[model samples]
Target: MSRRWNPVHPNVTGMLHGGDYNPDQWLDYPHIIDEDFRLMKLASANTFSVNIFGWSAIEPEEGVYRFEWLDSIMDRVAEQGGHIILATPSGARPAWMSEKYPEVLRVEANRVRNLHGVRHNHCFTSPIYRQKTQEMNRKLAERYKEHPALIMWHISNEYGGWCHCDLCQEAFRGWLKNKYDHDLDKLNHAWWTGFWSHRYSSWSQIESPAPHGENQVHGMNLDWQRFVTDQTIDFYQNEIVPLRELTPHIPVTTNFMGNYPHMRPFTGLNYEKFAKHVDVVTWDCYPPWHNDWQSTASLAKDVGFVNDLYRSLKDGQPFLIMECTPSLVNWHEVNKAKRAGMHKLSSIQSIAHGSDSILYFQWRKGRGASEKFHGAVVDHVGHEHTRVFRDVAEVGQVLNQLAPVVGSSMDAKVAIVYDWETDWAIADAQGFGKETKQYAATCQEHYRVFWERGIPVDVITPDKPLDGYKLVIAPMLYMVREGYAAKVESFVHSGGYFVATYATGMVNETDLVNLEGSPGPLKKVLGIWAEEIDTLYPAESRELVMTGGARYEAKDYVELIHLETAEALASFTSDFYKDKPALTVNRLGEGKAFYIASRNETSFQDDLYERLLDELQIGAPFPVQAGKGVSVQVRTDGKTDYVFVMNFTEEQQTVGWPGRSGLANLLTGEHVGEQLELEPYGAVVLSQSRE
Candidate 1:
């Protein structure tokens, strides 16, 4: 009988580990191959991602295929009781192909065509590239579908980066035709091309937006961003369909860069749109780099937020950590190494947020290449005794011991609403003195308050189902889609607490402002009108005195509101709008909607969060106040709870774990009391044993 994994895929072994094993780099000595099998066996690893960047190696000259070497690697892995994640080497076209069809190369905004060197610099619009990629995928599938080692199909590595060649521009026109139904007038209006005489009389009048530079029309910029994202998704769709037809049982997925805005060419990556094409969601986890000048606590928090974001993309289904550094990375200005015990901590962190597999970028370090210095499973010493190697082996052993974690899921009562369209619209806009740089910062501030207070929140798109969540927050929500206001109204009137900060419901889906009034669709539910928006100097601060005797220092953007049905909870104490409502609440049915018109101090936010939870009659799921630096996350196998307690700080600290007084850790089989001490970067999985 064939085995099945959660999210509807096959898994013939215990929780998958290992990644990107490019044995082709070590092909000089057959003994190296034998040694790899020995090391993988010693490490208890069962999965290997192969052919990640093997385009030239697999198809060197013309259509002459050379997968026999790959076949040998696949057989060797299978004989050693391992499975393969077969990757299509389409991320980079072979040098010969790129040399032949320069149209396949990427073109920058200045029209400088990129040379045939780096990966992900391929033109997304090249039909030749797409056709060759699809053919390669089809061949890879047919060749390995029956092989016992083949378990999954990886389409390409990190599928993004924009191109500006004429073919791509022509392809953009075709995509626009489909999007706008070939109506130039509608396109013109939607793009708001009247400004700067950008209106198109014919379909051929348009070109890539970056040439006009950053100061182009805002609506055009937003639409062009959406168009570029669509091009990437279209390429993925074409590649995946062929693979599915060839290997009916195999699941297909491509790794993502986990929504780090500005990493890709544009600021419009709709992760939700890409999630629909794959059987399982896979994302690379390389948190923002920190030098000696900065700290990594924020990095850990970012990982937590993104892990939940990707998990929410699959509707709480477990995803995979497709690429993470074994120790340090090479891209940043200062590449920082993972501290001792962080390997286990990071892996568990991913698993706690619903990742079934934890994999690395490559299995072994290279002798000479662009990424030779990057972290790898086998270091320069080429031995199993390295510190990083021990960590990798220990992680595999721990995963094998915790096999029951497979198929486990997590649920949250709080939801934070975010959208790529909203991000793009705000980023594209310039007239508002209220800046776009602080949009994500505003959301993260609210999320951090909850994180510090031990309140787990699911970062969700606005269109997600709101049936179960008690509190729904849309922070810096500037563009509210059609029917979304009605959805919020219904959710509030039906007893769900709704919280929106400044800039909520200001525009429609088309990046067009709601001329009716500010705070457009949510005005009725929020029961207030944004009379005016103002921004203060960075160092300047204002005061907000709440009804309950707490005073908060407010800063940045402020919306002076004229209330209708809303009752003032907090009033500003400075400026011409002194004593005006800064925070207002409106009661609907048994629920209430609170609108915060300005960013406030951290202490104020903490106090505000507690009051909201109290008013909503909701409490933390577990005793998350287990002291500082401790994170308590819980996941269930539907019936039993497996709680992960981790210490992110450097000093040893004792904290309380949720549930009965004492429980046995599955790893050590030792009974952990309610109060247990975790050393710096230590983590433990406490298994719940029910009566």
Candidate 2:
């Protein structure tokens, strides 16, 4: 039987409503409070993510407690019929705490300690920092455990970044000791420390990877990244244990940054381990409007991928969209306002993924802070007459009409493994590829092809089981972790089709290359051996002629390999490496493994992915060529299916329904038969016809 996601909170109806509400920051508390609640009602907002970044207000002094402000705020919100997702005020530590305990301040990669004023400045390894954070969380959870409005426990604000303080150094040594089992010889072997007279006789000799230091080692810096990720996870688990003890029923989670580079959300910290402690996995997604529409759609699909990551970790639990910018973001220099209807369309896109709730970064504009100019439901103007306000209200009304239609929708079976650790290792590699060739961009390129066709795809880790997916694509996977090759082999042996690209399986988890050969462990499964790597300079290009006589162009980082038993699918067709196998396929056991030796343009990659999908008999949510700029995604809860078709382009596009003759637009409550047309930036939520 397949899995399903259903929220237990009574006030959270079918669809999640409400957003981040910070009434504490507003000066005219009484008037603004009334207006905020009024706006929520007008927008049909139901969930209030409160207490975010309110440490100073809650615990002004070292130990003096003050919950009067929060007390009043929660009481009023509860009275207005709202559910609360209370956040632990750890993101923004108070100025006094930082000034008093300077050790809590985080040291950057350059060894400079940041002063308190800005958020995310606390060191994860700082004892005092953890103590204060835990104390604050304990107090907040104890005080609000039985609060009628309480529904979920949000621990910390978007957990990210790393620390390079003495504490972190000590912690890193301890982590390495455990990982290498205190065997200095193995540690030296893994990091190749003997090359630079860096062999460690004592674990204490190992220091934090600081960019400002003399003789910086990439291997050390790489390990430090992994160590910092583990430290942050430890901090989260520490806080979560106590919070769970207080309110076991309420789910606990910290907001994760989607595709965050620094944290490598998938590995090191082990999202699977983190998921065990977290009840509901939530993430913040804010793709600037200037990014490509296909990229944005791919990001929307990635939300489900993240959810699937958490689900796979926790045995299939639903995830939530904790924070998304409703309007213009303050971070970007030229923050363009989301085009009309684009906001609602994007919000539905999140829901189409496994998002149980959609919440914004802030409900009201900050009066004075780094995020003061950030987008909000109620802008700094303080009235509901603004364009953003009107759009928010319109979205709210649409949610009211479409509440029951798309409350609990699920997606497809195809999963693509996207490993951030592999990305990091690939980026940090010394040789074998061009510096400009990025793993994330390459993986995203492959995933975009499926996303554009409304084919549901999950960005997963290589360690994840591949029982359900028809095809698993792992691009630029440079690091091959322990037992992963065997798992991939097993998946392939079970009639699965796996595709891998160049620069894969070259290194171990420690960032050390496997000296045996290129594509180390994966070579057996691929039935090919990479003899030499051909690095192409900028503007250099090669052509790949498919078996069907279709030719595609390629550039940057081409691998010249010898096919042992694999059949050549495409040849290099350029350079001294001409006539070589640029692409190969090996029939291994009951499955097959395909290898692409170079990076190709979007058209080639898309055609390749589409052909694979066709061979696997994977079906998309909508018909091909329904519209050019319009994208469709389908989610279901067994009984009903909600199809979200969005027009991301500036020009209007028309979409056609082949099987269904008539459907009701959940957003507008309009009836349409067979075919429908959408304006620029328009969106339509179509439910399975009741008739």
The global C-alpha lDDT for each of the candidates, from Candidate 1 onward, is 0.79, 0.75
Identify the leading candidate in terms of TM-score: 1
The TM-score of predicted model 2 comes to: 0.93
- Writing each residue's lDDT as its tens digit, candidate 2 over 1-691 gives 1344557465566666668888767635688887887778777777888888888887888899879888987887788877888988888888898889999998987878897778888888888888888888889888998899898888888777888788888899988889888898888887788876878888888887656542345567667777777788889877776788888878778776654421124433445435555777777777665354444444544444555455445444557778888788787646778877778877766666656667887788878867888899888778888888788777777667766643354455676677767766666666744566667667666776877788867667665677777788888888888888888888888888999988888777777777878788888899888876777778787888876678888888888888888999899777777888888999988889999998888888878877888888888855635655567777666656678787766777878876676677787677778877778777788877322
Clashing residue pairs, backbone N/CA/C < 3 A, model 2? 17-46, 18-46, 410-636
Q: What is the lDDT of residue 535 in candidate 1?
A: 78
Q: Give the per-residue lDDT digits (tens) of candidate 1, residues 1-691.
A: 0112363345454678888888777777778778888889877788888998888888899889998889999998888778888998888778899888888899998889988888988988888988889888888888887998888888888877688899988988887888889999998888777878888999987777776566577666666777777888888888887778988888888887755421221134677777788788888886543445434555566677778778787677778888888788777666778878988888888887778887898788888878989998888787899999999999998888677878778757788887778878777667565453466556776776666666667878877888788899899899988888898998999999999987877777777778877689888999998877777778888999989878988888777888989999999998978989999999988789999988788897788878878877666555644656577777775456677877877778787745567676867878877777788888888787434
Which stretches of model 2 miss by more than 4 angstroms?
8-10, 212-216, 259-273, 291-316, 405-411, 432-435, 689-691
Angstrom error at residue 419, model 1: 1.0
